[model samples]
Target chain A: MNTTGPDSPSRRELFRMIGSVAGGAAMYQAMSTLGFAAESTYRGPVDLSGAPRGASVLILGAGIAGMTAAYELRNAGYKVQVLEYNHRAGGRNWSLRGGDTYTELGGFTQQCEFDEGLYLNPGPWRIPYHHRGLLSYCKKLGVPLEAFVQVNYNAYLHSSKAFGGKPQRYREIKADYQGHVAELLAKATRQSALDAAVSREDREKLLESLRDWGALDADFRYGANLLASERRGYAKEPGGGLTARPLPSQPIGLTDVLDSGLWQGIPSGDRYDMQTALFQPVGGMGRIGEAFARELGPLIRYNAKVVDIRQDVHGVTATYEDLAAPGTKLQARADWCLCTIPLTVLAQIPMNVGAALHAAISAVPYSSAVKVGLQFKRRFWEEDEHIYGGISYTDLPITNIAYPNTGYHSAGKGVLLGAYIWGQNAMEFTAMPPALRVRKAVEYGSRIHPQYPAEFDNGIAVAWHRSPFTLGCYGMWSEAARAQHYDNLCQVDGRIALAGEHASFIGGWQEGAVTSALDAIGRLHQRAIARGKKA
Target chain B: MSIRHVTIRLALAVLGLSAAAAQADDASFMPIADLGQANGEQIYQHICQGCHMPGGEGASGAGFYPKLAGDPRLASWQYAAVTVLNGRNAMPPFGLPEDRISETRTVHLSDAQVAEVVNYIRSHFGNTYADTLTAADIAPLPHPR
Candidate 1:
């Protein structure tokens, strides 16, 4: 059975078996010996050396994907040119600050009224530590990073149907739920209910672990005691002077905890992408895009929208209309083309790709999302609620209310992500006028934070469906669609290859765009070298 | 819990309900909050009108939303039903089955609701098609995954 013959478990499977038997650490070591478990696919800067002299590439969209390709290709001696639909670089990597004006489709224009230094990132806001490709560029571009708080124990978890529509503190719910579950399990263990599952000696050890893990008392029970209150906070906190004694808070009943549905919010921070050590650029997420723009200055042509993309045996040519001077069509041609235009917009453009690629392009439908930024007169979340940073989840149409992570305790004014609505809720919000959307967000958010009505100075709402640049938000791939057309979408068609968040597995993320661009260009480079040799 | 605490919680709940009711009474909030009981036109305005536009004269800029006004595609009631039920290109399926709908989806459309909206779209937007699609016609059409 252990023989290395046909029908034997492969090395990966063997390691997985080791993982099930030993643990993750031992399996990781075994896998690492086999050149696996390297985490992110990005090793370092892509080596696009030995480029054929004078090999030029015409890139579409000045997004992260396009810029990453241009920056690397240029250094590798490829004459690269990038055409952006928007006047700015960063397609979705955008931040709206004070004095900035945004005009969505249907002619609704909003000028940001946020105070100086206050901003709203309408796009990719948080960068996880595991997204090495994007982090590497942030480092290379000299963009300073700051901690982006994903979860705060003091933040809220609200459901309009639960707890009589009253919002609950995250820590209280988390502690109570864990304590009750542990207490129940301990009861089972002590009653010999786990006699078949656990060894006689291990039962005591499991109970001991549960007591500490669940904040249970010495008798392996959870109640309104100091031990439980220490985990969820005291009703009367310990003080420095007289009247210093702390009062233990009563825990909600197990049935109430189960019925509240607040337990769903507990594991959000434990998710791989949402785990701690997340970073954001100091000023805004747009800093990374701006830095890339500065680095690839003259190479990028802003306000040039590609209307037609055609390719032949010779090379690829793109017919673009310069938005500044509307009707006149300008042409750019190169040996190869890298199109980073989003699938939503690209499906509309006349790109001469094969039937499979075209079918793949039309297959993925972009998801609807709406983000509303409300500028308040003061930092009431900090001053009043003590919610310094992190998001509050709600069951209302306005799905989340994210407090600002930066400038904690600062006076004057602050901007909060009043709402991050998605799915059906987003569609409804998108249908409304921008002002009405903002008003609704305020109304809904007020349920969680009663200070909203008095504090809200102004707001700007961006409904991705109404956004003219990329039409809808990010590509939403059904498992079936990805299985059928993902490879076809990524493969090079004639002289053109596609790359963006849509083209990568890590959709709706900057890391997807970065990694996808690197992957596309690496293949493109190989093809170019081969073509160069043939030439 | 203490009696006083229970009383305070009840008061807060009452306040929240009244505030929501008052907002619902306001004309501005009518279109968005009452999706569960909205009519065909109301559903269109609340959902489909964003990308397709208020008049159904689709706008084009970064991407093109094909004009539904006098669109030959909607002439076939089955075409309209399938598109709304299964989605086509950039359009999201408004009539996905409850189990198929993503977790983020808060609203679900029934077959009758889908028919109602489809009929509304076909008749309005400068489009006049007498053939009304029934909920029975929509129920049996295969949803391509």
Candidate 2:
């Protein structure tokens, strides 16, 4: 019980000491022990080789989950058909460009007006390296990949109430914060404050590491010096000839660094999901969905909205209204059904399932989110501020501005994600009309990028709650709800099963859809085989 | 002052009262916490009107938003209060803790605010319920764990 004594080292302090002595690899190992890092469970493709002959599966919603199931099931010798509500293959995996029009729930239509070769991906945009399932499909489908920058040191971290509303460069904040922390730790070690935590031999090594890692001087202090400038950038460049002298920039005070709250933005890229080597599809996020559609062209029936779903001892049937021809009903039947419809819409459909599954269906609620994409007359962020291919965060309602990761230093107009708003902010933005949402985004974003007023050409805003296909952005599963209902939601009730991002632990991600589909179909295939054997 | 100037000042004064209570004057940005909206009408306009529509007549396309204007459910203020405090189906709970709802930033309505909005909706929008509910009524309602 005397763990607070000097002899007992806290886990955090032990990890920090290990990170200081060893390198990133040891730090990653320590993090892994604490359950901070999670690797993808995808090991190659799904093995569905034993699908029973004449067995059929009717998939609902041609989103990532539906398409993935259809593709894999068909390849495994099962006859599969997919019904989609939207005319397009990708439901939320959508990209908007010039000539594309969208009509939301309120009957307001917006036509994207970005120039050629410029588009906005309003859905799942980036694919992490560990998301082997989605990445494997990208490779198999011939969708080229490009690096998506998650963090740019040259980008800005701003607080409206701090720094007199002036933006601070991310590199300065990061370097100064690390340097000051290192200096303080070194001071503690020199004073023998960490004597019980570290051995005498390790203490010398720790001070040396602090000097190197923190850019501390001979006296083990972090201040205005050329070494600190090397990490945080120099005020004056070291020119070639006569003006070769460099002026070091002063580090912000530790108090100011802590008060500004810019430290919150530093660890964004360090998260497992947003780490480095993140990638995007070449054209847009929708390209992966398009590739799936191209592969499963005839099997997918678009613009088919299912009104009723019923299952008997023999098979499953879905009655859908063909939107192209209003008031006409058509039925699709199969031996098995894998429904990937979002629960928000599925709750309204008449489906026969157990009370447990029905309660699970009605338990989870979706989140409200808004994203605004603005087209500017020029690449002003790169040209003016030297910020290329990263996000600038602010406390304003327009949460953050993300610059286009591709087409760096090109001529013509550029597009920026002007706002990525969530929660109450999203609801407020959703309350306004489409045009007004765009205007308000431009107005709030102007506080960060002053060039917005003059350079704004055209913009489009999407409130996920107002979007007809998905009532809200993504499924929000409370801890209690997930504990009580998650397994029930995933279980197969009679001849039907459900799979999507909503059913998986990784919500709001394509990887979730892919992995959940694979998991669901794996079970469905086994059931189909078992039924065939019995029959 | 000119008549136009006087009218503009009067309008701004009314707006300022709400803004001062919210502790933010920017028309475009609304803070998530401590909204400080005065009454039920203002709270509904600031929060509920987005999905429920301006007149409480909900819209449907991709998903259905149930109409609240002439709904028979408002007859029982307890039903409305419980639903608002603990969401059903696709609607998130407006009165729960932010962490409980899995949202980092969301509208967290106090008991008084919930009562106000509930009372306002019950009386207006074609519903004539003279019964009134108070914060005391809402405070006792069971919340989802």
Candidate 3:
């Protein structure tokens, strides 16, 4: 019952099942027929057929936004070049692994101590099933995708306030909440409490539906019985042969359940965006970036830190420094510009753009997020708790602990998202040293998984604000700021335009980056064609 | 600032570890037995160091923590002082809310410590600013609810 439905098959599982039986083309068609397909703003592959003759465009940052622009424009027969501060592609779409050293703005380098084949996606970790554009790119780039479990029945829902700080299985909370609601509603319906709203026949139907849906007994009570036990789980699971008999577990009272607030995490996976069939790259989220980089090949320039951006009626040019060498100025020029650098970092750079655009640039602020990746000696969550994959929600400062979705049931070391703090809690974590952050994460996570302190081998923590590349996590647009500047931020300013999560409605997501890039490039292409006609 | 530029900032992170090293030296002789009263890097290490880097580099991945190392934003000491003492957007107020401090234990900076850390960040971390914060400067600000 912790899951949204009875075995909501993942997109991958559904696709494979449909593909094997119905073929690839038939699977695509059956996907819709089966009513499991997600409808997105993306209408299949984008058509970029009419690029101007020999027009060139310069892109800033090799993040998903910039790379999406590059990947599409090059296919449309235009010359494209991308400038990135880091040596690799994918700005926020990054992953850290063994032997990888990260130097934050303040130059304290922490080399990732993760073991082989293990990695921590410090950036965009999960891809929603509805983010069609990103998913299409994953397919096109040959980046295999797998289901990212957002909820597991055995995973925990912990509240520090109630249950004496003990963690509760997600199934217990979800099943009990629905049971109480059903019992109350069924009782009300049977007693004519809904006489004004429903006909007697309809009330009888509603009562019957509630009993079945809530796993209620014939009398419509959700008590210690086999019917309720089927949903909430049994004390001793039914087995075959001699030990097949089952014992029903008592459901927690509604008052205790309400006060505990474990219900807060029960519906997390039920959200439209966080539903079943969620995905991640087969290896890590960073693989998508690396795949895009591979597709772009030599077109991307690494370690080019943009310091200034200038544009004239004819073309746009960016002045950058060779970050590898330090202080040496370099230049890259093109007829049009699509700057995907985060607003926080971009605001500090000088640019030749209109006042409106400048104001828009300075208007938005980026958010703060911190992630701690802790490597454990073994897959304890899977081995001991049977929580194969999914997240454990907690009221502790760590906020949430996410078990690895990949390498499930394997006899090997594993990495867990030990801490994912946001807002004020994130700031408190961000203020600490990396080692201390890791230590603190282990400390807090131990409450949910008592095996944490013993199993934790090494950990790496990334505080997004400390990154020199983007300077912040993602653009955060307040209602007041969006009202004044959201449109202005997206409008192509002269020959210069900006594209990134900051320039779109879906801020803080890669889908925003992908779609915003597509929109910006489409407009830029139109402008380029118009300029060609004039020329 | 958005939540991206959320937490403690290292005024001097990107430049080098010298700023953190210098602060470490200042706190080297302090009694480790009393972390609650420790000042300078000790306070920063125990409090702000989780989100901010040891050298004041705020953490980064998808979120942003403004670096304390010679950040151009630090030009306005009042802005810096207010951001830390009163807290900024997404950053919980570090002053007057004793419950908040009791909850986290890291942000429990005394009036004197708040002023001291601000002054330390401004003066160190590759910043050569002469103007520094004082307890008097912090004491005058109204405590946030």
lDDT per residue (tens digit) for residues A223-304 in model 1 = 8999999989899998888989999999989877766666666666766677789999998999999999999999999889
Q: B1-145, model 3: which lDDT tens digit per residue?
A: 1221222224334446553233332222222224346566555654565445666666443234667887998888777777776555334346735444422221345677777877778777688888767788888776543
> How do the residues A109-212 of candidate 2 rate in per-residue lDDT, one tens digit apiece?
99999999888898777888998998999999999999998889998888777788788999999899788878888899999998877788878887887888
A479-502: candidate 3 lDDT, tens digit per residue: 556788888989999888889887
Candidate order, DockQ descending: 2, 1, 3
- Superposed by TM-score, candidate 3 places the C-alpha of residue A378 at a distance from the truth, in angstroms, of 1.4
Show how many residue pairs clash in every candidate, following the order shown: 0, 1, 52
Candidate 3: count of backbone clashes, pairs at least 3 residues apart or interchain? 52
- Preferred candidate (DockQ higher): 1 or 3: 1
lDDT of each: 0.82, 0.82, 0.74
Candidate ranking (TM-score, best to worst): 2, 1, 3
- Candidate 3 ranges beyond 4 A from true positions: A1-40, A533-535, B1-145
TM-score of 2: 0.91
Residue A383 local lDDT, model 2: 98
How much of the true A–B contact set does each candidate keep?
0.59, 0.63, 0.15
Note the residue pairs that clash in candidate 1: none
Report how far off residue A400 is in candidate 3 (Å).
1.2
> By the TM-score metric, which is better: model 2 or model 3?
2
lDDT of 1 at A531: 84
